[model samples]
Target: MSTANERARMTDLALQEWGVVVGILAERGESWPDTDVTRWGPGVTAAMERTRALCAACSIVGATEAADIGRLADLYEARTRS
Candidate 1:
């Protein structure tokens, strides 16, 4: 039920957080741990699902782009978390 602007802000925040995590992972040259699947997986999955729904409802191309950015963030979160 978020407005477009709110969704955009959320997407930006997610991307920023993901970028930091990815940078750390790259520097470590190590994959993330998989044992804690229950912790990160559900959150990432929910984020992606929300992002996809937001993309579908987006009225502006920019909003769609923001959603795409959010998707990338979710991808990074999933990859780095496991």
Candidate 2:
């Protein structure tokens, strides 16, 4: 668990790491438009729907947890590795 301020900080860290992912993709002469998935078949779209449902239970529109921010950082790392 994390305080709101801590979650905000982690979000910033995750975003900065994602910027590195973008740089790595740019070096390979690829961009988002070139590698877009037609649509998330099931795994991602279903997860997104579930996440939205959980978020709806929160009183805040954009409430977030530290673990969620950490997950974003993990996704950024995976993107750079792939």
The best candidate by lDDT is 1
Write model 2 residue lDDT over 13-49, tens digit each, in one string.
Answer: 5445445444544665654335444543454345444
| Candidate 1 lDDT by residue in tens digits, 1-79 | 6576776665565555546544554454633442233444444546545544545544243444444544555555675
List runs of model 2 lying over 4 Å from the truth.
Answer: 33-82
Using all chains and alpha carbons, the TM-scores for the candidates as numbered come to 0.40, 0.40
Candidate 2's displacement at residue 73, Å, is 11
Model 2 residue-pair collision total: 0
* Structural RMSD, model 2: 9.1
TM-score of 2: 0.40
**Poorest lDDT segment (10 consecutive residues) of candidate 1:** 30-39
Candidate 1 vs. true structure, TM-score: 0.40
With a 3 Å backbone cut-off (N, CA, C), the pairs that clash in candidate 2 are none
